[model samples]
Target: MYICLEGIDGSGKTTQIKLLESWIQKCGIDVLRVFEPTDNEVGKLIRKLLQNPDAINENFQITLALLFAADRTVLMRDITEAEALAKIVISDRSFYSSMVYQNDSEWIAEINKHAKQPDLVILLDINPETAVSRCDGMDSFEEQNFLASTAKKYLELADHQNFMVVNANNGINKVHDDIKRIVAHKLGMCI
Candidate 1:
């Protein structure tokens, strides 16, 4: 199963992912934990550019969209080719995030063209205001208008089809429990 966890920065996706992976492993499932904007050469440059917001001047939006797409493509290919022994692949971020960053409505229509869809897309839903304060003053794509826009986009995307939307405003353990419920329901695992 391909399971993806997505949300704005400071939404606790990174923390919860570790917990989720551990829980799944304890159930005797082999889990693959993968994250994007990888440490690969090309992805490294993209990460540097994205972090230095001031350095972006030309085609900034397109640059990030393409960079994320490339990273997802690499990830998708690798995961698909892996042996089935890895029962579940949990990704911290996935192609849906690119759609949010690009803020393109066409993304929803063309989403499947880029990469394989996940069996379950777990959205850690948090309002943009809460998301910003969670960052503790550091500014990034997740703190500004981008967060608002993306959160809206995510809602719109979710409305089109059924996906798990877990409220991330609560404490970490609560959020983890919610995710466990969702995953158990989806996979029909003993809870």
Candidate 2:
């Protein structure tokens, strides 16, 4: 099973993921927790390029889309295959981040054809203002307007069955419990 957690930076996704990982382990399931923009060679370059504002200057949209796609390719090839020891793989960010950042439905759809879809995608839905306030490491992308637009794009293109919007504005434990409930129903695991 592949479970992904996504949201704007400050939405407490990492906290929830950590909590969920602990909870799942307590349930006696082996889980592998992973994050995108992995630390591998190609992934390292991609992460550097994305974090550097100047790198986004030339052909912004195209650059962003291609970099994300490349990162996903590396991840899929290296980690998501049958050799994985854990029965469940949980990712902090997946293709949904690319779709939200690019804001192009057609592009996202095309990419989805090649990308592996998560069995469950938890979108920690938080308004931009709240999102910014909660975020710790402020980058250019953390600006309120940028976050709001990205989040709106995520909501617009997501399907109900595969995607869920959780109220992340609530405290971390509340959000974690909500996510646990969702995973329990989808994976039929004891909580």
Candidate 3:
């Protein structure tokens, strides 16, 4: 099973991933936790670009999207290996993030055409204001208007059967419980 968790900054995706990892382990399942941009060479470039505001400009979205696609291609190989090992792969982000963050262009879709889709995509839904308040530092894409737009795009691309939008405003435990329920149902594991 390939499970993905996505949300804007401060939406608690990292926290939930950790909790889910523990829960899945307790269920006697081997879980492979992967994150994008991965720790590879291309991923390193993406991380640097993210931290250096001056390195990004109007065309940054296009560049970043392509980099993300490259990183995902590398990640796909790892995912296949983990799956062959019978481990459930859980990713922090995936192509859905590109669809939400990048410009609405066919190029974005083309870049990610070869990427594998997640069996389940859990989108942690939170208002931009709330998300901004929860975050300590803002990235280029984490600004109010940008996050608002990203959130809108996520909703627009959401598929009811494959996607679940969990209210991130809820307390951590409550949010985790909600995610756990969804993951359990999808994976056919008892929670």
Candidate 4:
């Protein structure tokens, strides 16, 4: 099972992924943990570009989109191999981020066609203001207005068979319970 947690920054995906991985392990499931914008060379370049908002002009968006795709192309191999070993692969972000953050959705999808699709996508939905406040506007991506638009796009993308939406305004424990319930039910895990 490949499970991905998606949402705007400060939506607690990092926190929840850690908790979920710990719990799943307690349930005797071997989990392979990974995250996008990985520490690879391409991912490092993406991180570098993102820190300078000036570098993210309209034309550069396409370059960022391609970078994300190239990064995921490498990640998909590990995800596929781990899943084949009966490991539950959990990822913090995926090509889905590119779909939402980048300008051209169709082109983003095409570029990421080689990426592995998640069997389940749990979106940690949160108010844009609340999300930005949580992260302290750490990067260009953490701006409230930008996150608002991105949140809307995420919700729109959530209308899918494999998608699960979790309201993230609640306290961390409550949000985690909801994720656990959703995952347990969807995957038929007794954990």
Give each model a TM-score: 0.87, 0.86, 0.92, 0.93
Q: Clashing residue pairs, candidate 2?
A: none
Off by over 4 Å in 1: 54-58, 105-114, 139-142
Q: Is 1 or 4 the stronger prediction by lDDT? A: 4
What would you estimate as the lDDT of candidate 1?
0.79
> Please, what are the lDDT tens digits per residue for candidate 1 over residues 96-187?
77766565647533643667788889999997878888788756663577788778788777776566899999999999999999999888
What lDDT score is found at residue 124 in candidate 2? 88
- In model 4, the Cα lDDT at residue 61 comes to 81
lDDT of 3 by residue, 96-180 (tens): 8887777765788898888998989999998988888888776445488888887877777776335898999899999999999
**How accurate locally is residue 103 in candidate 3, as Cα lDDT from 0 to 100?**
71
lDDT of 2 by residue, 164-187 (tens): 889988988889889999999988
What lDDT tens digits, residue by residue, belong to model 4 across residues 1-191? Answer: 89999999899999999999998888888999999898889889989988876766887787878888998898888888998999999999988888888877788888888988888999999998788778853545536678898899999888854579999999999999999998898778765
Q: Judged by lDDT relative to the true structure, which candidate is superior, 2 or 3?
A: 3
Q: Count the backbone clashes (under 3 Å) in each candidate.
A: 0, 0, 0, 0
lDDT of each candidate versus the true structure: 0.79, 0.78, 0.87, 0.87
Which parts of model 4 have CA positions greater than 4 angstroms off?
138-142, 160-162
Worst-scoring 10-residue span by lDDT in model 2: 77-86
Q: Quick one: ranking by TM-score, best first?
A: 4, 3, 1, 2
